[model samples]
Target: MDFPETVRWTFAGLACLTLAALVREIRRLRRAEPGGRARVRWDAADQGAGLVLTVGGALGSLHLFGAGLVLTGVVLGGKAVRAVRARRRTTVGRPST
Candidate 1:
Protein backbone atom coordinates (compact mmCIF):
# COMPACT_ATOMS: atom_id res chain seq x y z
CA MET A 1 0.00 0.00 0.00
CA ASP A 2 1.34 3.39 -1.02
CA PHE A 3 1.02 5.95 1.73
CA PRO A 4 1.00 9.59 0.77
CA GLU A 5 3.92 11.75 1.88
CA THR A 6 1.57 13.74 4.10
CA VAL A 7 0.45 10.61 5.92
CA ARG A 8 4.06 9.68 6.57
CA TRP A 9 4.78 13.16 7.85
CA THR A 10 1.78 13.09 10.12
CA PHE A 11 2.87 9.82 11.67
CA ALA A 12 6.39 11.17 12.08
CA GLY A 13 4.97 14.18 13.84
CA LEU A 14 2.88 12.02 16.19
CA ALA A 15 5.90 9.86 16.96
CA CYS A 16 7.93 12.94 17.84
CA LEU A 17 5.20 14.21 20.12
CA THR A 18 4.92 10.84 21.84
CA LEU A 19 8.66 10.77 22.38
CA ALA A 20 8.56 14.22 23.95
CA ALA A 21 5.72 13.22 26.24
CA LEU A 22 7.55 10.06 27.27
CA VAL A 23 10.63 12.04 28.18
CA ARG A 24 8.66 14.53 30.22
CA GLU A 25 6.85 11.79 32.09
CA ILE A 26 10.10 10.02 32.88
CA ARG A 27 11.59 13.18 34.27
CA ARG A 28 8.55 13.79 36.41
CA LEU A 29 8.59 10.26 37.71
CA ARG A 30 12.25 10.53 38.62
CA ARG A 31 11.66 13.76 40.53
CA ALA A 32 8.75 12.31 42.45
CA GLU A 33 9.42 10.65 45.78
CA PRO A 34 9.64 6.89 45.64
CA GLY A 35 6.08 5.63 45.85
CA GLY A 36 4.64 2.15 46.04
CA ARG A 37 6.37 -0.57 44.08
CA ALA A 38 3.24 -1.12 42.01
CA ARG A 39 3.04 2.55 41.06
CA VAL A 40 6.64 2.53 39.93
CA ARG A 41 6.04 -0.61 37.95
CA TRP A 42 2.98 0.85 36.29
CA ASP A 43 4.87 4.01 35.35
CA ALA A 44 7.66 1.94 33.83
CA ALA A 45 5.14 -0.14 31.93
CA ASP A 46 3.44 2.98 30.65
CA GLN A 47 6.72 4.36 29.37
CA GLY A 48 7.57 1.11 27.65
CA ALA A 49 4.14 0.93 26.04
CA GLY A 50 4.41 4.53 24.82
CA LEU A 51 7.76 3.80 23.22
CA VAL A 52 6.35 0.73 21.47
CA LEU A 53 3.34 2.65 20.24
CA THR A 54 5.50 5.42 18.86
CA VAL A 55 7.71 2.99 16.97
CA GLY A 56 4.70 1.08 15.67
CA GLY A 57 3.08 4.25 14.40
CA ALA A 58 6.21 5.40 12.61
CA LEU A 59 6.80 2.00 11.04
CA GLY A 60 3.19 1.67 10.00
CA SER A 61 3.39 4.95 8.13
CA LEU A 62 6.54 3.82 6.32
CA HIS A 63 4.86 0.51 5.49
CA LEU A 64 7.75 -1.37 7.02
CA PHE A 65 5.39 -3.52 9.09
CA GLY A 66 1.76 -4.65 9.09
CA ALA A 67 -1.00 -3.44 11.38
CA GLY A 68 -0.18 -6.16 13.91
CA LEU A 69 2.38 -4.01 15.67
CA VAL A 70 0.05 -1.05 15.61
CA LEU A 71 -2.67 -3.18 17.11
CA THR A 72 -0.37 -4.44 19.84
CA GLY A 73 0.69 -0.93 20.62
CA VAL A 74 -2.91 0.17 20.89
CA VAL A 75 -3.68 -2.65 23.28
CA LEU A 76 -0.69 -1.83 25.46
CA GLY A 77 -1.60 1.83 25.40
CA GLY A 78 -5.08 1.01 26.66
CA LYS A 79 -3.64 -1.04 29.51
CA ALA A 80 -1.39 1.83 30.47
CA VAL A 81 -4.34 4.20 30.54
CA ARG A 82 -6.32 1.85 32.74
CA ALA A 83 -3.42 1.43 35.12
CA VAL A 84 -3.03 5.18 35.41
CA ARG A 85 -6.70 5.67 36.11
CA ALA A 86 -6.68 2.95 38.72
CA ARG A 87 -3.64 4.47 40.38
CA ARG A 88 -5.29 7.88 40.46
CA ARG A 89 -8.41 6.49 42.05
CA THR A 90 -6.40 4.80 44.74
CA THR A 91 -4.60 8.04 45.58
CA VAL A 92 -7.46 10.51 45.28
CA GLY A 93 -8.37 10.71 48.94
CA ARG A 94 -4.81 10.94 50.20
CA PRO A 95 -3.62 14.27 51.55
CA SER A 96 -0.73 15.95 49.76
CA THR A 97 2.46 16.31 51.76
Candidate 2:
Protein backbone atom coordinates (compact mmCIF):
# COMPACT_ATOMS: atom_id res chain seq x y z
CA MET A 1 0.00 0.00 0.00
CA ASP A 2 1.17 3.48 -0.74
CA PHE A 3 1.43 6.04 2.03
CA PRO A 4 1.13 9.81 1.74
CA GLU A 5 4.09 12.14 2.02
CA THR A 6 2.92 13.39 5.44
CA VAL A 7 2.68 9.85 6.83
CA ARG A 8 6.15 9.04 5.53
CA TRP A 9 7.57 12.17 7.09
CA THR A 10 5.84 11.43 10.37
CA PHE A 11 7.31 7.95 10.48
CA ALA A 12 10.71 9.35 9.64
CA GLY A 13 10.43 11.79 12.54
CA LEU A 14 9.37 9.04 14.88
CA ALA A 15 12.31 6.94 13.74
CA CYS A 16 14.72 9.76 14.45
CA LEU A 17 13.31 10.31 17.92
CA THR A 18 13.43 6.63 18.72
CA LEU A 19 17.04 6.38 17.62
CA ALA A 20 17.96 9.42 19.72
CA ALA A 21 16.25 7.92 22.75
CA LEU A 22 17.99 4.60 22.21
CA VAL A 23 21.36 6.29 22.11
CA ARG A 24 20.61 8.23 25.28
CA GLU A 25 19.53 5.13 27.15
CA ILE A 26 22.56 3.17 26.05
CA ARG A 27 24.87 5.91 27.25
CA ARG A 28 23.07 5.99 30.58
CA LEU A 29 23.47 2.25 30.92
CA ARG A 30 27.19 2.50 30.22
CA ARG A 31 27.97 5.13 32.82
CA ALA A 32 30.90 4.44 35.13
CA GLU A 33 30.58 3.26 38.70
CA PRO A 34 31.87 4.84 41.88
CA GLY A 35 35.12 4.16 43.79
CA GLY A 36 37.35 4.68 40.75
CA ARG A 37 35.77 1.72 39.00
CA ALA A 38 35.91 2.31 35.26
CA ARG A 39 32.83 0.22 34.62
CA VAL A 40 29.40 -0.70 35.86
CA ARG A 41 26.92 -3.48 35.38
CA TRP A 42 23.67 -3.14 33.42
CA ASP A 43 20.14 -4.42 33.57
CA ALA A 44 19.24 -6.87 30.83
CA ALA A 45 15.61 -5.72 30.78
CA ASP A 46 16.60 -2.11 30.16
CA GLN A 47 19.05 -3.16 27.50
CA GLY A 48 16.36 -5.21 25.81
CA ALA A 49 13.98 -2.24 25.85
CA GLY A 50 16.62 -0.12 24.17
CA LEU A 51 17.12 -2.80 21.55
CA VAL A 52 13.41 -3.02 20.90
CA LEU A 53 13.18 0.71 20.43
CA THR A 54 16.13 0.66 18.06
CA VAL A 55 14.59 -2.12 15.97
CA GLY A 56 11.25 -0.34 15.89
CA GLY A 57 12.92 2.81 14.63
CA ALA A 58 14.77 0.94 11.91
CA LEU A 59 11.60 -0.82 10.79
CA GLY A 60 9.77 2.51 10.59
CA SER A 61 12.59 4.00 8.57
CA LEU A 62 12.45 1.08 6.16
CA HIS A 63 8.68 1.67 5.64
CA LEU A 64 7.63 -1.32 7.69
CA PHE A 65 5.27 0.79 9.79
CA GLY A 66 3.21 -2.13 11.01
CA ALA A 67 6.27 -3.91 12.35
CA GLY A 68 7.35 -0.71 14.00
CA LEU A 69 4.03 -0.47 15.81
CA VAL A 70 4.40 -4.06 16.98
CA LEU A 71 7.83 -3.40 18.34
CA THR A 72 6.62 -0.25 20.04
CA GLY A 73 3.95 -2.38 21.71
CA VAL A 74 6.68 -4.72 22.90
CA VAL A 75 8.63 -1.84 24.41
CA LEU A 76 5.50 -0.54 26.17
CA GLY A 77 4.64 -4.01 27.45
CA GLY A 78 8.12 -4.42 28.85
CA LYS A 79 7.86 -1.11 30.66
CA ALA A 80 4.49 -2.06 32.12
CA VAL A 81 5.89 -5.37 33.37
CA ARG A 82 8.83 -3.64 34.96
CA ALA A 83 6.61 -1.09 36.63
CA VAL A 84 4.37 -3.80 38.07
CA ARG A 85 7.35 -5.71 39.37
CA ALA A 86 8.80 -2.63 40.99
CA ARG A 87 5.47 -1.80 42.64
CA ARG A 88 5.14 -5.35 43.91
CA ARG A 89 8.62 -5.26 45.32
CA THR A 90 8.04 -2.00 47.15
CA THR A 91 4.66 -3.10 48.50
CA VAL A 92 6.03 -6.43 49.60
CA GLY A 93 8.68 -4.67 51.63
CA ARG A 94 5.96 -2.86 53.61
CA PRO A 95 3.93 -5.90 54.53
CA SER A 96 1.85 -5.63 57.75
CA THR A 97 3.07 -9.03 58.96
Give each prediction's root-mean-square deviation over alpha carbons.
6.5, 5.8
Best by TM-score: 2
Error of 1 at 7 (Å): 1.2
Tens digits of lDDT, candidate 1, 9-75: 7767877876777687677677777665445545555655555655655555333334435655665
lDDT value, candidate 2, whole model: 0.54
Local lDDT at 33 for model 1 = 74
Estimated TM-score per prediction?
A: 0.51, 0.58
Model 1 score (lDDT): 0.63
Clashing pairs in 1: none
- List the candidate 2 regions with Cα displacement exceeding 4 Å: 32-63
The CA root-mean-square deviation of candidate 1, after full C-alpha superposition on the true structure, stands at: 6.5
Give per-residue CA lDDT, model 2, range 1-97, as digits (tens). 4556666566557657656765665565567456322211223334444445444444444444455456557666766776688789999868586
* Leading candidate by lDDT: 1
